[model samples]
Target: MNPGGLDYNYEDWTTIMNMTAKTSVLNLTQEEFIYPGNRACSGCGLSILYRIGLKALGRDCIFVVPPSCLTVMQGLFPIAATQMPVLNCTFASTAAIATGVRAAMKRLGRDTQVVAWAGDGGTSDIGIQALSGALERVEDIIYICYDNEAYMNTGVQRSGTTPQGTLTTTTPLSGKAEASKNIPAIIAAHNPAYLATCSASYPLDFHDKLLKAKEIKGLKYLHIQTPCPPGWGCEERMTVEIGRTAVETGLFDLYEIEDGQMKLSGPSQKLLGKTSLRPVREYLEMQVRFKALSDEQINVMQAEIDQKWAGYRDTF
Candidate 1:
Protein backbone atom coordinates (compact mmCIF):
# COMPACT_ATOMS: atom_id res chain seq x y z
CA MET A 1 0.00 0.00 0.00
CA ASN A 2 1.17 3.54 -0.81
CA PRO A 3 1.35 6.33 1.73
CA GLY A 4 -2.00 7.52 0.37
CA GLY A 5 -3.59 4.21 1.42
CA LEU A 6 -3.84 3.07 -2.21
CA ASP A 7 -2.81 -0.42 -3.19
CA TYR A 8 -0.60 -0.66 -6.29
CA ASN A 9 -1.75 -3.95 -7.72
CA TYR A 10 0.12 -6.07 -10.23
CA GLU A 11 -2.09 -4.68 -13.01
CA ASP A 12 -1.14 -1.14 -12.05
CA TRP A 13 2.52 -2.10 -12.13
CA THR A 14 2.01 -3.64 -15.57
CA THR A 15 0.35 -0.46 -16.81
CA ILE A 16 3.23 1.69 -15.59
CA MET A 17 5.74 -0.67 -17.11
CA ASN A 18 3.94 -0.75 -20.46
CA MET A 19 3.82 3.06 -20.60
CA THR A 20 7.37 3.02 -22.01
CA ALA A 21 6.02 2.53 -25.53
CA LYS A 22 6.87 5.18 -28.18
CA THR A 23 3.41 6.65 -27.72
CA SER A 24 4.23 7.24 -24.06
CA VAL A 25 5.94 10.47 -25.13
CA LEU A 26 2.46 11.96 -25.27
CA ASN A 27 1.92 10.99 -21.64
CA LEU A 28 4.63 13.38 -20.38
CA THR A 29 3.37 16.71 -19.13
CA GLN A 30 3.78 19.77 -21.34
CA GLU A 31 4.79 21.71 -18.26
CA GLU A 32 8.33 23.04 -18.24
CA PHE A 33 10.32 23.29 -15.03
CA ILE A 34 13.87 23.77 -16.37
CA TYR A 35 14.48 26.87 -18.45
CA PRO A 36 15.93 26.75 -21.95
CA GLY A 37 19.15 28.71 -21.46
CA ASN A 38 21.74 27.36 -19.02
CA ARG A 39 25.47 26.80 -18.41
CA ALA A 40 25.32 23.11 -19.42
CA CYS A 41 27.76 22.12 -22.17
CA SER A 42 26.56 21.34 -25.67
CA GLY A 43 24.94 17.89 -25.88
CA CYS A 44 24.96 17.49 -22.11
CA GLY A 45 23.24 14.24 -21.03
CA LEU A 46 22.35 15.75 -17.64
CA SER A 47 20.36 18.45 -19.42
CA ILE A 48 18.11 15.85 -21.03
CA LEU A 49 17.68 13.83 -17.84
CA TYR A 50 17.05 16.96 -15.72
CA ARG A 51 14.29 18.22 -18.00
CA ILE A 52 12.35 14.94 -18.12
CA GLY A 53 13.02 14.11 -14.48
CA LEU A 54 11.58 17.41 -13.28
CA LYS A 55 8.47 16.88 -15.39
CA ALA A 56 7.98 13.51 -13.70
CA LEU A 57 8.76 14.95 -10.23
CA GLY A 58 6.45 17.92 -10.82
CA ARG A 59 6.61 21.06 -8.61
CA ASP A 60 5.91 19.45 -5.26
CA CYS A 61 9.52 18.75 -4.49
CA ILE A 62 12.73 20.33 -3.18
CA PHE A 63 16.22 19.70 -4.56
CA VAL A 64 19.41 19.48 -2.55
CA VAL A 65 22.28 19.80 -5.01
CA PRO A 66 25.96 19.41 -4.18
CA PRO A 67 28.99 21.12 -5.67
CA SER A 68 29.16 19.52 -9.10
CA CYS A 69 28.34 20.13 -12.75
CA LEU A 70 24.70 20.68 -11.80
CA THR A 71 25.75 23.52 -9.54
CA VAL A 72 27.38 25.18 -12.53
CA MET A 73 24.45 24.27 -14.80
CA GLN A 74 21.95 25.89 -12.44
CA GLY A 75 24.07 29.07 -12.42
CA LEU A 76 25.20 31.18 -9.47
CA PHE A 77 23.29 32.93 -6.70
CA PRO A 78 20.91 35.59 -8.16
CA ILE A 79 20.71 33.75 -11.49
CA ALA A 80 19.20 30.27 -11.87
CA ALA A 81 18.19 27.91 -14.67
CA THR A 82 15.54 25.75 -13.04
CA GLN A 83 12.04 26.97 -12.16
CA MET A 84 11.96 25.18 -8.82
CA PRO A 85 13.44 25.66 -5.35
CA VAL A 86 16.98 24.27 -5.07
CA LEU A 87 19.21 24.19 -2.01
CA ASN A 88 22.88 24.28 -2.81
CA CYS A 89 24.87 22.31 -0.29
CA THR A 90 28.50 21.29 0.30
CA PHE A 91 29.98 18.38 -1.65
CA ALA A 92 29.95 15.87 1.23
CA SER A 93 26.75 17.04 2.91
CA THR A 94 24.11 16.54 0.25
CA ALA A 95 22.26 13.74 1.99
CA ALA A 96 22.64 15.31 5.43
CA ILE A 97 21.29 18.61 4.15
CA ALA A 98 18.43 16.77 2.43
CA THR A 99 17.57 15.02 5.67
CA GLY A 100 17.33 18.39 7.39
CA VAL A 101 15.15 19.70 4.59
CA ARG A 102 12.79 16.75 4.91
CA ALA A 103 12.49 17.35 8.62
CA ALA A 104 11.70 21.03 8.05
CA MET A 105 8.97 20.14 5.56
CA LYS A 106 7.38 17.71 7.98
CA ARG A 107 7.51 20.24 10.80
CA LEU A 108 5.64 22.71 8.62
CA GLY A 109 2.97 20.12 7.87
CA ARG A 110 4.17 19.88 4.29
CA ASP A 111 4.85 16.61 2.48
CA THR A 112 7.14 17.86 -0.22
CA GLN A 113 9.57 15.29 -1.56
CA VAL A 114 13.22 15.97 -0.78
CA VAL A 115 15.72 15.08 -3.50
CA ALA A 116 19.50 14.99 -3.17
CA TRP A 117 21.32 15.42 -6.46
CA ALA A 118 25.05 14.79 -6.65
CA GLY A 119 27.75 13.65 -9.03
CA ASP A 120 29.83 10.44 -9.03
CA GLY A 121 32.62 11.93 -6.90
CA GLY A 122 30.22 13.42 -4.41
CA THR A 123 28.26 10.17 -4.20
CA SER A 124 30.55 7.13 -4.42
CA ASP A 125 33.60 8.75 -2.86
CA ILE A 126 33.18 11.81 -0.67
CA GLY A 127 29.55 11.70 0.45
CA ILE A 128 29.10 7.95 0.82
CA GLN A 129 29.13 7.92 4.62
CA ALA A 130 26.23 10.35 4.92
CA LEU A 131 24.32 8.54 2.19
CA SER A 132 24.82 5.21 3.93
CA GLY A 133 23.56 6.73 7.18
CA ALA A 134 20.49 8.15 5.46
CA LEU A 135 19.66 4.77 3.94
CA GLU A 136 20.21 2.98 7.23
CA ARG A 137 17.81 5.36 8.95
CA VAL A 138 15.36 4.94 6.05
CA GLU A 139 15.11 8.66 5.52
CA ASP A 140 12.14 9.80 3.44
CA ILE A 141 14.11 11.31 0.54
CA ILE A 142 15.21 10.64 -3.02
CA TYR A 143 18.93 10.55 -3.77
CA ILE A 144 20.13 10.73 -7.38
CA CYS A 145 23.76 10.34 -8.42
CA TYR A 146 24.43 11.40 -11.99
CA ASP A 147 27.50 9.32 -12.83
CA ASN A 148 29.57 10.84 -15.62
CA GLU A 149 32.49 8.58 -14.50
CA ALA A 150 35.02 11.30 -13.59
CA TYR A 151 34.89 14.54 -11.61
CA MET A 152 34.10 16.56 -14.68
CA ASN A 153 33.40 19.86 -12.99
CA THR A 154 36.82 19.73 -11.35
CA GLY A 155 39.05 19.55 -14.43
CA VAL A 156 38.25 15.91 -15.33
CA GLN A 157 40.00 14.38 -12.34
CA ARG A 158 39.91 10.66 -11.64
CA SER A 159 37.13 9.72 -9.25
CA GLY A 160 36.21 6.45 -7.55
CA THR A 161 33.64 5.75 -10.24
CA THR A 162 35.92 6.48 -13.18
CA PRO A 163 36.15 3.38 -15.38
CA GLN A 164 39.45 1.53 -15.63
CA GLY A 165 41.71 2.39 -18.58
CA THR A 166 39.83 5.68 -19.07
CA LEU A 167 42.18 8.64 -19.29
CA THR A 168 41.71 11.42 -16.80
CA THR A 169 43.84 14.43 -15.79
CA THR A 170 45.06 12.54 -12.71
CA THR A 171 45.73 9.39 -14.70
CA PRO A 172 46.73 10.73 -18.09
CA LEU A 173 49.17 8.30 -19.78
CA SER A 174 48.07 4.81 -18.70
CA GLY A 175 44.55 5.81 -17.60
CA LYS A 176 43.00 4.88 -14.29
CA ALA A 177 44.24 1.56 -12.90
CA GLU A 178 41.28 0.79 -10.61
CA ALA A 179 37.97 -0.25 -12.03
CA SER A 180 34.94 1.91 -11.41
CA LYS A 181 33.29 1.25 -8.07
CA ASN A 182 30.04 -0.68 -8.27
CA ILE A 183 27.88 2.11 -6.81
CA PRO A 184 24.52 0.48 -7.58
CA ALA A 185 25.62 -2.68 -5.82
CA ILE A 186 26.82 -0.65 -2.83
CA ILE A 187 23.56 1.29 -2.67
CA ALA A 188 21.52 -1.89 -3.13
CA ALA A 189 23.16 -3.36 -0.06
CA HIS A 190 21.44 -0.66 1.97
CA ASN A 191 18.11 -2.02 0.74
CA PRO A 192 16.16 1.19 0.48
CA ALA A 193 12.44 1.21 -0.28
CA TYR A 194 13.24 1.88 -3.95
CA LEU A 195 16.39 1.70 -6.08
CA ALA A 196 16.89 1.97 -9.83
CA THR A 197 19.58 2.39 -12.49
CA CYS A 198 18.86 4.78 -15.37
CA SER A 199 20.68 6.23 -18.37
CA ALA A 200 20.54 9.63 -20.04
CA SER A 201 20.01 8.01 -23.45
CA TYR A 202 16.55 6.82 -22.34
CA PRO A 203 14.80 9.79 -20.72
CA LEU A 204 11.36 8.24 -20.74
CA ASP A 205 12.65 5.24 -18.83
CA PHE A 206 14.10 7.60 -16.23
CA HIS A 207 10.89 9.63 -16.14
CA ASP A 208 8.82 6.54 -15.37
CA LYS A 209 11.29 5.46 -12.69
CA LEU A 210 11.15 8.86 -10.97
CA LEU A 211 7.35 8.80 -11.07
CA LYS A 212 7.38 5.39 -9.40
CA ALA A 213 9.84 6.61 -6.76
CA LYS A 214 7.64 9.59 -5.93
CA GLU A 215 4.81 7.25 -5.05
CA ILE A 216 6.86 5.29 -2.56
CA LYS A 217 8.02 6.29 0.92
CA GLY A 218 11.31 5.86 2.77
CA LEU A 219 14.74 6.14 1.14
CA LYS A 220 14.74 5.99 -2.68
CA TYR A 221 18.04 5.88 -4.56
CA LEU A 222 18.55 6.32 -8.32
CA HIS A 223 21.82 6.14 -10.23
CA ILE A 224 21.95 7.54 -13.78
CA GLN A 225 24.78 7.07 -16.29
CA THR A 226 25.20 10.60 -17.68
CA PRO A 227 27.49 11.01 -20.66
CA CYS A 228 30.00 13.87 -20.60
CA PRO A 229 31.08 15.08 -24.00
CA PRO A 230 34.07 17.10 -22.82
CA GLY A 231 35.06 14.78 -19.99
CA TRP A 232 34.70 11.63 -22.05
CA GLY A 233 36.51 13.23 -25.04
CA CYS A 234 33.56 12.69 -27.37
CA GLU A 235 32.04 15.17 -29.79
CA GLU A 236 29.30 17.32 -28.29
CA ARG A 237 26.63 15.74 -30.50
CA MET A 238 27.69 12.18 -29.65
CA THR A 239 26.55 12.27 -26.01
CA VAL A 240 23.24 10.47 -26.51
CA GLU A 241 24.74 7.92 -28.90
CA ILE A 242 27.55 7.16 -26.45
CA GLY A 243 25.11 6.70 -23.59
CA ARG A 244 22.89 4.39 -25.67
CA THR A 245 25.93 2.41 -26.78
CA ALA A 246 26.97 1.96 -23.16
CA VAL A 247 23.74 0.10 -22.44
CA GLU A 248 23.72 -1.77 -25.75
CA THR A 249 27.27 -2.98 -25.02
CA GLY A 250 26.25 -4.28 -21.60
CA LEU A 251 28.72 -1.94 -19.84
CA PHE A 252 25.69 -0.55 -18.07
CA ASP A 253 22.32 -2.16 -17.33
CA LEU A 254 19.01 -0.55 -16.41
CA TYR A 255 16.87 -2.08 -13.68
CA GLU A 256 15.04 -1.47 -10.44
CA ILE A 257 15.34 -2.99 -6.98
CA GLU A 258 12.07 -2.50 -5.15
CA ASP A 259 12.06 -3.62 -1.53
CA GLY A 260 15.07 -5.91 -2.16
CA GLN A 261 13.65 -7.60 -5.31
CA MET A 262 15.56 -6.90 -8.56
CA LYS A 263 14.24 -6.90 -12.14
CA LEU A 264 15.71 -5.75 -15.44
CA SER A 265 13.98 -2.94 -17.34
CA GLY A 266 14.11 -0.95 -20.62
CA PRO A 267 16.68 -1.87 -23.32
CA SER A 268 18.65 -3.92 -20.81
CA GLN A 269 15.61 -6.16 -20.34
CA LYS A 270 15.69 -7.09 -24.03
CA LEU A 271 19.41 -7.86 -23.68
CA LEU A 272 19.13 -10.85 -21.35
CA GLY A 273 21.89 -13.07 -22.76
CA LYS A 274 25.53 -12.16 -23.36
CA THR A 275 25.04 -12.87 -27.07
CA SER A 276 22.53 -10.04 -27.25
CA LEU A 277 25.12 -7.47 -26.15
CA ARG A 278 27.21 -5.49 -28.59
CA PRO A 279 31.00 -5.56 -28.39
CA VAL A 280 32.37 -3.47 -25.52
CA ARG A 281 35.07 -2.29 -27.92
CA GLU A 282 32.39 -0.48 -29.91
CA TYR A 283 31.49 1.62 -26.89
CA LEU A 284 35.13 2.31 -25.99
CA GLU A 285 36.14 3.27 -29.51
CA MET A 286 33.58 6.06 -29.60
CA GLN A 287 35.18 7.91 -26.68
CA VAL A 288 38.66 9.45 -26.86
CA ARG A 289 39.16 8.83 -23.14
CA PHE A 290 39.59 5.14 -23.91
CA LYS A 291 42.27 5.80 -26.53
CA ALA A 292 44.98 4.67 -24.14
CA LEU A 293 43.37 1.29 -23.50
CA SER A 294 45.20 -1.60 -25.18
CA ASP A 295 43.37 -4.40 -26.99
CA GLU A 296 44.09 -6.70 -24.01
CA GLN A 297 42.56 -4.21 -21.59
CA ILE A 298 39.49 -3.95 -23.80
CA ASN A 299 39.21 -7.73 -23.86
CA VAL A 300 39.41 -7.86 -20.07
CA MET A 301 36.52 -5.37 -19.85
CA GLN A 302 34.49 -7.38 -22.35
CA ALA A 303 35.08 -10.60 -20.44
CA GLU A 304 33.93 -8.92 -17.22
CA ILE A 305 30.71 -7.75 -18.88
CA ASP A 306 30.02 -11.23 -20.27
CA GLN A 307 30.58 -12.79 -16.87
CA LYS A 308 28.19 -10.26 -15.31
CA TRP A 309 25.46 -11.08 -17.83
CA ALA A 310 25.99 -14.77 -17.28
CA GLY A 311 25.17 -14.21 -13.62
CA TYR A 312 22.12 -12.12 -14.50
CA ARG A 313 20.86 -14.81 -16.88
CA ASP A 314 21.12 -17.33 -14.11
CA THR A 315 19.34 -15.11 -11.59
CA PHE A 316 16.71 -13.16 -13.59
Candidate 2:
Protein backbone atom coordinates (compact mmCIF):
# COMPACT_ATOMS: atom_id res chain seq x y z
CA MET A 1 0.00 0.00 0.00
CA ASN A 2 2.86 2.39 -0.65
CA PRO A 3 1.17 5.03 -2.88
CA GLY A 4 -1.69 3.57 -4.92
CA GLY A 5 -3.76 3.01 -1.71
CA LEU A 6 -4.54 -0.58 -2.69
CA ASP A 7 -5.11 -3.46 -0.32
CA TYR A 8 -2.38 -5.65 -1.74
CA ASN A 9 1.24 -4.42 -1.47
CA TYR A 10 2.69 -2.44 -4.39
CA GLU A 11 5.50 -4.94 -4.57
CA ASP A 12 2.97 -7.73 -5.04
CA TRP A 13 1.05 -5.82 -7.74
CA THR A 14 4.30 -5.19 -9.60
CA THR A 15 4.82 -8.93 -9.49
CA ILE A 16 1.41 -9.26 -11.13
CA MET A 17 2.24 -6.75 -13.90
CA ASN A 18 5.48 -8.74 -14.31
CA MET A 19 7.14 -5.66 -15.81
CA THR A 20 10.05 -3.75 -14.37
CA ALA A 21 8.59 -0.31 -13.65
CA LYS A 22 11.03 2.58 -13.88
CA THR A 23 11.28 3.61 -10.27
CA SER A 24 13.13 6.83 -11.06
CA VAL A 25 14.24 9.06 -13.94
CA LEU A 26 17.58 7.25 -14.05
CA ASN A 27 15.87 4.06 -15.24
CA LEU A 28 14.31 6.11 -18.06
CA THR A 29 17.79 6.96 -19.35
CA GLN A 30 18.22 3.52 -20.91
CA GLU A 31 16.00 3.51 -24.03
CA GLU A 32 12.40 3.77 -25.21
CA PHE A 33 10.39 1.03 -26.91
CA ILE A 34 7.04 0.56 -28.71
CA TYR A 35 6.72 4.28 -29.51
CA PRO A 36 3.90 6.24 -27.94
CA GLY A 37 1.88 7.48 -30.96
CA ASN A 38 0.33 4.73 -33.04
CA ARG A 39 -3.08 3.57 -34.36
CA ALA A 40 -3.97 0.70 -32.05
CA CYS A 41 -7.54 0.47 -30.75
CA SER A 42 -8.46 1.69 -27.26
CA GLY A 43 -7.75 -1.64 -25.52
CA CYS A 44 -5.76 -3.68 -27.99
CA GLY A 45 -4.07 -6.57 -26.17
CA LEU A 46 -1.40 -6.91 -28.87
CA SER A 47 -0.22 -3.36 -28.10
CA ILE A 48 0.06 -4.28 -24.42
CA LEU A 49 2.23 -7.29 -25.33
CA TYR A 50 4.33 -5.15 -27.68
CA ARG A 51 5.00 -2.62 -24.90
CA ILE A 52 6.02 -5.30 -22.39
CA GLY A 53 8.10 -7.19 -24.98
CA LEU A 54 10.02 -4.05 -25.92
CA LYS A 55 10.64 -3.24 -22.27
CA ALA A 56 12.01 -6.73 -21.65
CA LEU A 57 14.08 -7.02 -24.84
CA GLY A 58 15.33 -3.40 -24.78
CA ARG A 59 16.24 -1.35 -27.88
CA ASP A 60 19.31 -3.36 -28.90
CA CYS A 61 17.11 -5.35 -31.22
CA ILE A 62 16.04 -5.27 -34.86
CA PHE A 63 12.53 -6.22 -35.96
CA VAL A 64 11.39 -8.01 -39.12
CA VAL A 65 7.75 -6.90 -39.30
CA PRO A 66 5.58 -8.17 -42.11
CA PRO A 67 2.23 -7.15 -43.64
CA SER A 68 -0.58 -7.52 -41.13
CA CYS A 69 -2.66 -5.55 -38.65
CA LEU A 70 0.55 -4.63 -36.83
CA THR A 71 1.69 -3.14 -40.11
CA VAL A 72 -1.47 -1.03 -40.20
CA MET A 73 -1.32 -0.24 -36.48
CA GLN A 74 2.31 0.83 -36.83
CA GLY A 75 1.10 2.93 -39.77
CA LEU A 76 2.34 3.50 -43.30
CA PHE A 77 5.66 4.97 -44.44
CA PRO A 78 7.16 7.68 -42.13
CA ILE A 79 5.22 6.57 -39.03
CA ALA A 80 6.00 3.48 -36.92
CA ALA A 81 4.98 2.37 -33.47
CA THR A 82 8.28 0.75 -32.58
CA GLN A 83 11.30 2.98 -31.91
CA MET A 84 13.78 0.20 -32.75
CA PRO A 85 15.07 -0.42 -36.25
CA VAL A 86 12.23 -2.09 -38.16
CA LEU A 87 12.58 -3.87 -41.49
CA ASN A 88 9.32 -4.13 -43.34
CA CYS A 89 9.23 -7.23 -45.54
CA THR A 90 6.68 -8.87 -47.82
CA PHE A 91 3.82 -10.70 -46.12
CA ALA A 92 5.07 -14.19 -46.97
CA SER A 93 8.76 -13.54 -46.36
CA THR A 94 9.10 -12.48 -42.72
CA ALA A 95 11.12 -15.53 -41.72
CA ALA A 96 13.34 -15.24 -44.78
CA ILE A 97 13.93 -11.56 -44.04
CA ALA A 98 14.72 -12.32 -40.39
CA THR A 99 17.20 -14.99 -41.43
CA GLY A 100 18.91 -12.50 -43.70
CA VAL A 101 19.09 -9.89 -40.94
CA ARG A 102 20.55 -12.41 -38.47
CA ALA A 103 23.14 -13.53 -40.98
CA ALA A 104 24.10 -9.92 -41.73
CA MET A 105 24.38 -9.13 -38.02
CA LYS A 106 26.68 -12.11 -37.51
CA ARG A 107 28.87 -11.15 -40.50
CA LEU A 108 29.23 -7.62 -39.15
CA GLY A 109 30.24 -9.04 -35.73
CA ARG A 110 27.29 -7.17 -34.20
CA ASP A 111 25.47 -8.67 -31.25
CA THR A 112 21.84 -7.81 -31.81
CA GLN A 113 18.72 -9.92 -31.39
CA VAL A 114 16.71 -10.25 -34.59
CA VAL A 115 12.99 -10.76 -34.14
CA ALA A 116 10.37 -11.62 -36.75
CA TRP A 117 6.91 -10.43 -35.78
CA ALA A 118 3.97 -11.55 -37.91
CA GLY A 119 0.27 -12.26 -37.68
CA ASP A 120 -1.55 -15.63 -37.56
CA GLY A 121 -2.45 -15.46 -41.23
CA GLY A 122 1.15 -14.60 -42.05
CA THR A 123 2.83 -17.29 -39.98
CA SER A 124 0.38 -20.19 -39.79
CA ASP A 125 -0.75 -19.88 -43.38
CA ILE A 126 1.01 -17.61 -45.88
CA GLY A 127 4.51 -17.46 -44.40
CA ILE A 128 4.77 -21.12 -43.46
CA GLN A 129 7.24 -21.88 -46.22
CA ALA A 130 9.64 -19.08 -45.26
CA LEU A 131 9.27 -19.95 -41.58
CA SER A 132 10.03 -23.61 -42.25
CA GLY A 133 13.08 -22.70 -44.29
CA ALA A 134 14.48 -20.44 -41.54
CA LEU A 135 13.83 -23.02 -38.82
CA GLU A 136 15.39 -25.78 -40.86
CA ARG A 137 18.57 -23.71 -41.13
CA VAL A 138 18.40 -22.87 -37.42
CA GLU A 139 18.87 -19.14 -37.94
CA ASP A 140 19.43 -16.92 -34.91
CA ILE A 141 16.03 -15.24 -34.70
CA ILE A 142 13.01 -14.95 -32.43
CA TYR A 143 9.73 -15.36 -34.26
CA ILE A 144 6.61 -14.09 -32.50
CA CYS A 145 3.19 -14.57 -34.10
CA TYR A 146 0.57 -12.33 -32.48
CA ASP A 147 -2.39 -14.58 -33.29
CA ASN A 148 -5.69 -12.71 -33.18
CA GLU A 149 -7.17 -15.90 -34.74
CA ALA A 150 -8.09 -14.25 -38.04
CA TYR A 151 -6.92 -11.99 -40.82
CA MET A 152 -8.01 -8.86 -39.00
CA ASN A 153 -6.30 -6.48 -41.39
CA THR A 154 -8.17 -8.09 -44.26
CA GLY A 155 -11.59 -7.48 -42.76
CA VAL A 156 -11.78 -10.30 -40.20
CA GLN A 157 -11.41 -13.18 -42.63
CA ARG A 158 -10.82 -16.62 -41.12
CA SER A 159 -7.30 -17.97 -40.86
CA GLY A 160 -5.91 -21.37 -39.88
CA THR A 161 -5.88 -20.17 -36.26
CA THR A 162 -9.58 -19.36 -36.15
CA PRO A 163 -11.47 -21.88 -34.00
CA GLN A 164 -14.49 -23.83 -35.18
CA GLY A 165 -18.02 -22.49 -34.76
CA THR A 166 -16.76 -18.94 -35.24
CA LEU A 167 -18.30 -16.33 -37.54
CA THR A 168 -15.58 -14.96 -39.75
CA THR A 169 -15.98 -13.59 -43.27
CA THR A 170 -15.07 -16.95 -44.79
CA THR A 171 -16.58 -19.17 -42.12
CA PRO A 172 -19.94 -17.73 -41.28
CA LEU A 173 -22.39 -18.99 -38.63
CA SER A 174 -22.89 -22.05 -40.84
CA GLY A 175 -19.96 -23.50 -38.80
CA LYS A 176 -16.45 -24.47 -39.91
CA ALA A 177 -15.67 -28.16 -40.22
CA GLU A 178 -11.94 -27.63 -39.95
CA ALA A 179 -10.26 -27.10 -36.59
CA SER A 180 -7.96 -24.29 -35.50
CA LYS A 181 -4.38 -25.05 -36.45
CA ASN A 182 -2.07 -26.03 -33.59
CA ILE A 183 0.77 -23.57 -34.17
CA PRO A 184 3.00 -24.53 -31.23
CA ALA A 185 3.18 -28.16 -32.29
CA ILE A 186 3.72 -27.07 -35.89
CA ILE A 187 6.79 -25.06 -34.81
CA ALA A 188 7.88 -27.67 -32.31
CA ALA A 189 7.97 -30.17 -35.17
CA HIS A 190 10.84 -28.02 -36.48
CA ASN A 191 12.69 -28.64 -33.19
CA PRO A 192 13.75 -25.06 -32.53
CA ALA A 193 15.62 -24.00 -29.37
CA TYR A 194 12.45 -22.61 -27.77
CA LEU A 195 8.72 -22.41 -28.55
CA ALA A 196 5.84 -21.24 -26.39
CA THR A 197 2.31 -19.78 -26.25
CA CYS A 198 1.58 -16.68 -24.20
CA SER A 199 -1.30 -14.40 -23.29
CA ALA A 200 -1.44 -10.94 -21.69
CA SER A 201 -3.65 -12.35 -18.96
CA TYR A 202 -0.56 -14.12 -17.61
CA PRO A 203 2.08 -11.44 -17.87
CA LEU A 204 4.63 -13.05 -15.56
CA ASP A 205 4.55 -16.22 -17.61
CA PHE A 206 4.97 -14.13 -20.77
CA HIS A 207 7.94 -12.16 -19.36
CA ASP A 208 9.68 -15.30 -18.14
CA LYS A 209 9.33 -16.99 -21.54
CA LEU A 210 10.62 -13.92 -23.42
CA LEU A 211 13.62 -13.71 -21.07
CA LYS A 212 14.32 -17.37 -21.72
CA ALA A 213 13.92 -16.88 -25.49
CA LYS A 214 16.47 -14.04 -25.36
CA GLU A 215 18.98 -16.26 -23.58
CA ILE A 216 18.78 -18.95 -26.24
CA LYS A 217 20.87 -18.62 -29.41
CA GLY A 218 18.95 -20.31 -32.19
CA LEU A 219 15.40 -19.89 -33.46
CA LYS A 220 12.80 -19.16 -30.77
CA TYR A 221 9.08 -19.00 -31.42
CA LEU A 222 6.28 -17.55 -29.32
CA HIS A 223 2.63 -17.77 -30.42
CA ILE A 224 0.77 -15.18 -28.36
CA GLN A 225 -3.03 -15.12 -27.87
CA THR A 226 -4.24 -11.60 -28.69
CA PRO A 227 -7.88 -10.61 -28.61
CA CYS A 228 -9.39 -8.09 -31.04
CA PRO A 229 -12.53 -6.20 -30.00
CA PRO A 230 -13.95 -5.51 -33.47
CA GLY A 231 -12.89 -8.89 -34.77
CA TRP A 232 -14.21 -10.92 -31.85
CA GLY A 233 -17.34 -8.84 -31.31
CA CYS A 234 -16.39 -8.05 -27.71
CA GLU A 235 -16.11 -4.77 -25.85
CA GLU A 236 -12.70 -3.07 -25.92
CA ARG A 237 -12.25 -3.22 -22.12
CA MET A 238 -12.66 -7.00 -22.14
CA THR A 239 -9.53 -7.56 -24.23
CA VAL A 240 -7.30 -8.81 -21.44
CA GLU A 241 -10.10 -10.67 -19.69
CA ILE A 242 -10.91 -12.56 -22.91
CA GLY A 243 -7.30 -13.72 -23.09
CA ARG A 244 -7.43 -14.84 -19.45
CA THR A 245 -10.63 -16.74 -20.06
CA ALA A 246 -9.11 -18.49 -23.10
CA VAL A 247 -6.48 -20.07 -20.85
CA GLU A 248 -8.76 -20.59 -17.82
CA THR A 249 -11.29 -22.44 -19.95
CA GLY A 250 -8.58 -24.39 -21.79
CA LEU A 251 -9.60 -22.94 -25.13
CA PHE A 252 -5.94 -21.96 -25.14
CA ASP A 253 -3.25 -23.32 -22.83
CA LEU A 254 -0.09 -21.53 -21.82
CA TYR A 255 2.60 -23.95 -22.93
CA GLU A 256 6.22 -24.24 -23.97
CA ILE A 257 8.71 -26.62 -25.58
CA GLU A 258 12.48 -26.96 -25.33
CA ASP A 259 14.67 -29.15 -27.53
CA GLY A 260 11.55 -31.19 -28.42
CA GLN A 261 10.25 -31.55 -24.85
CA MET A 262 7.00 -29.81 -23.81
CA LYS A 263 5.94 -27.95 -20.67
CA LEU A 264 2.93 -26.10 -19.23
CA SER A 265 3.69 -22.76 -17.52
CA GLY A 266 0.59 -21.63 -15.64
CA PRO A 267 -1.58 -22.50 -12.61
CA SER A 268 -4.57 -23.21 -14.86
CA GLN A 269 -2.92 -26.41 -16.03
CA LYS A 270 -2.90 -27.76 -12.50
CA LEU A 271 -6.51 -26.69 -11.97
CA LEU A 272 -7.45 -28.36 -15.24
CA GLY A 273 -5.57 -31.48 -14.25
CA LYS A 274 -7.60 -31.93 -11.05
CA THR A 275 -11.05 -30.75 -12.06
CA SER A 276 -13.60 -31.81 -14.62
CA LEU A 277 -13.52 -29.82 -17.83
CA ARG A 278 -15.93 -26.90 -18.07
CA PRO A 279 -18.46 -26.48 -20.89
CA VAL A 280 -17.18 -24.83 -24.04
CA ARG A 281 -20.28 -22.65 -23.94
CA GLU A 282 -18.88 -21.05 -20.78
CA TYR A 283 -15.97 -19.77 -22.85
CA LEU A 284 -17.85 -19.02 -26.10
CA GLU A 285 -20.57 -16.93 -24.48
CA MET A 286 -18.25 -13.95 -24.09
CA GLN A 287 -17.84 -13.52 -27.88
CA VAL A 288 -20.47 -13.01 -30.59
CA ARG A 289 -19.15 -15.76 -32.86
CA PHE A 290 -21.14 -18.34 -30.98
CA LYS A 291 -24.30 -16.27 -30.85
CA ALA A 292 -25.86 -18.23 -33.69
CA LEU A 293 -24.64 -21.63 -32.49
CA SER A 294 -27.47 -24.11 -32.21
CA ASP A 295 -27.77 -26.69 -29.43
CA GLU A 296 -26.48 -29.37 -31.82
CA GLN A 297 -23.53 -27.27 -32.92
CA ILE A 298 -22.71 -26.48 -29.29
CA ASN A 299 -22.57 -30.19 -28.54
CA VAL A 300 -20.23 -30.73 -31.47
CA MET A 301 -17.93 -28.01 -30.11
CA GLN A 302 -18.07 -29.56 -26.64
CA ALA A 303 -17.10 -32.98 -27.97
CA GLU A 304 -14.25 -31.49 -29.96
CA ILE A 305 -13.00 -29.60 -26.93
CA ASP A 306 -13.17 -32.72 -24.79
CA GLN A 307 -11.12 -34.72 -27.27
CA LYS A 308 -8.59 -31.94 -27.72
CA TRP A 309 -8.22 -31.36 -23.99
CA ALA A 310 -7.75 -35.06 -23.38
CA GLY A 311 -4.99 -35.23 -25.94
CA TYR A 312 -3.33 -32.12 -24.44
CA ARG A 313 -3.59 -33.51 -20.92
CA ASP A 314 -1.99 -36.75 -22.09
CA THR A 315 0.98 -34.79 -23.37
CA PHE A 316 1.75 -33.63 -19.81
On TM-score, the candidate that comes out on top is: 1
lDDT of 1 by residue, 1-316 (tens): 1334444443453454456543155445556788889999999999998998887777888999999999989877788999889999998999999999999998999989999999999999999999999999899999999999999999899999999888999999999998889999999998899999999999988988988898899999999999999999999989989999999998899999986899999899889844668999999999999999999998988899999899999998
TM-score of 1: 0.92
lDDT of 2 by residue, 199-281 (tens): 96665566667767888989999999999988988999888888887777666778788877777777456645654666667
Model 2 TM: 0.86
Candidate 2 stretches greater than 4 Å from native = 1-32, 307-315
C-alpha local distance difference test of each model: 0.89, 0.79
lDDT of 2: 0.79
Best by lDDT: 1
Instruction: Evaluate residue 53 in candidate 2 and report its C-alpha lDDT on the 0 to 100 scale.
Output: 74
